[model samples]
Target: MISKRHADILKILDSSGTVTVAELANLLGVSTETVRRDLRPLVEDGAVHRMHGAVSLTGPTAEAPFRRRMRENAPAKQAIAARVAATILDGQTVMLDTGTTTSFIARALTGHRRLRVVTNSMDVARTLAVTGGNRVFLTAGEVRPDSGAALGPAAVAHVLQFRADVAVISAGGVDALAVTDYDPDEAEFARALLTCAPRRVVATDATKFGRRGLVAVVGFDGMDELVTDAAPPAVIASAMAAGGARLVLAG
Candidate 1:
């Protein structure tokens, strides 16, 4: 029988690829010995792998597809979303690009009323459209089956039609040079959305720190703020300082 504690451990591993045993013990409010006892059966069954002082998911369960990315670093993404949502007021217009972090942001904004949302993510649209007395404009474009994001020229043109109070985007990577994306169409669409808002915010998790993606979305100079779960590397921090973009660390 899987105890509730066992289930909680799996959930944590699903969100964070690896975690120290001490961290898990702290999170579960148990002693290290207890955690070890709970992990024994799970390890024996090959549901999780044990490192010297940490644990991680095993085999195919560790793979991160788009849907899996939604689960990855979930707590960090949620914290980032909460920080971004705190800056947005009710009845404000928000522009968002498609990405897993932005999808988290959409859920965070559900409490706000009368929000005008413009987005190219079907997930974002579906999340905010039904609740909050908000009006959501979903762009028409070539929808990627993997992410349910509308991309390409049509999406860019659709986003260009509206100006917003704020634009929140997600990144595949954030290095010293720029914020970047894995897909060219996603990058192009994000660039267009950035132009539509005076306050452009990039929300990414700590795992993206120092990674370089295939396509450049924008340099720090192009954005007003960068929000993440942890402090960036010194080089990336220096670049953001040089570019005059505020760095917001999510609590």
Candidate 2:
């Protein structure tokens, strides 16, 4: 049987994706040694993965589900979202792809007015459609149960039909070479969004820095800007500079 403490730890991991040992110890009102003891069984069961001083649901290769991803690095995501939203004009047309960060961007945009939003994310559509007198176009295609994102060729075709002022996308991982995603269909969809707009922005938290992803969405040359809560590592920063992409750090 899972102990109450173990269950609580799982809950925190489920929501936060990763937490430091010190933070967990503080939250649990226990010593670091006690937290380590509780984590051992969970790690053995493959319920969580341990790092040097922290724990996460698993390695970056396995993408977390949408709800969990939304909760993960939430404050940083919100800050990035706000920063991106501020750069957008009140009445500009925007193309957005499906991802947790982009969902936060949609929410941050609720205060703006007369915006035309194009997206494959049901979460983005529902958030922006009723507020701000925005016209939201939800792409048509098969929806993924985990993300509620429309995917496949039909969705790509739907996105290509509109021209927008800006395109904002979230990535699963971002290495020096490219912005990437775990799902091939979503990566293809993001590529389409990039083409539909002149200004292409990638919104991701710092956790994605230097992480490897399964599918390449776009090379840095194809990106206009990167919005995040922290500075990227040297390799990534150099790549962004070489590609002429601006890196905006959010508070």
Candidate 3:
């Protein structure tokens, strides 16, 4: 029941996480007004969400499903997680948000002992809870089936109650300007987690470079470290320098 234009729009959004009205029009070879018209029914059908001036598969389908996302860039994510895990000391309280990369990070923490792991991700909670020496806390909130993440006001409030030594997060995009997310509520939830933690780390792969999202979780300055499989583009280097963020490239 989807039109060709709608199908193409969804395809682009799936690959890049977000696309603006003007950008879509140019890519589709249609007028801006025409592209807007095409987006109306798609948005109504719960196929996508419109935010600010762009459209993305947000809300329930913020990125991709858990199992599918776990396979996407699996190797890169594991490397990033391993590098992130290496920086953590035993007995440290670490916080993480819901995302496949963070799930990998949780798996990487299994070897550490007596650590407290707090997360809004059901998968992350389950992964670490069964580990022999780690204590896991799953926050109270509405769990979105699509992402298996606890988000919204209640989750943010719950995160405020716990202060962490480090917070590991993932993003739809790590733009030259800021770290962004396609879901607004998730972005706010991440912002709350960042504020509650003394050190904040962002885990993402190289594909996120130059991508766009509906909302920015934080500016570059808010990130204490960025762990990825490859080095960032030259454009981000200036921002990292100005923000005092250390870039850690994993193997």
In candidate 3, how many clashes are counted?
Answer: 0
Q: For every model shown, what is its TM-score relative to the native structure? A: 0.76, 0.78, 0.82
Tens digit of lDDT per residue, candidate 3, span 1-251? 23999999988878756567867888899998999999999899889877666777755656554565677788999999999999999999999998889999989988888889889999998988887688988998999976789998999999999989999889878878999887898899988899878899999988777766779998888989888999888988788878989888998
Name the lDDT of candidate 1. 0.89
The candidate 1 region of ten consecutive residues with least summed lDDT is: 59-68
The lDDT ranking, best first, is 1, 2, 3
Scored by lDDT, the top model is 1
Question: What order do you get sorting by TM-score, best first?
Answer: 3, 2, 1
Each candidate: what lDDT? 0.89, 0.89, 0.86
lDDT digits (tens) for residues 120-223 of candidate 1 = 99999999999979999999899987679999999999899999999999997888999987678999999999999999999999988866677899998999
Instruction: Judge candidate 3 at residue 249 and give its lDDT.
Output: 94
TM-score attained by model 2: 0.78
lDDT of 2 by residue, 71-173 (tens): 7789999999999999999999999899989999999999999999999999999999999889999999899876799999999999999999999999878
Q: Which of candidates 1 and 3 is the stronger one according to TM-score?
A: 3
Clashes of each: 0, 0, 0
Off by over 4 Å in 2: 1-64
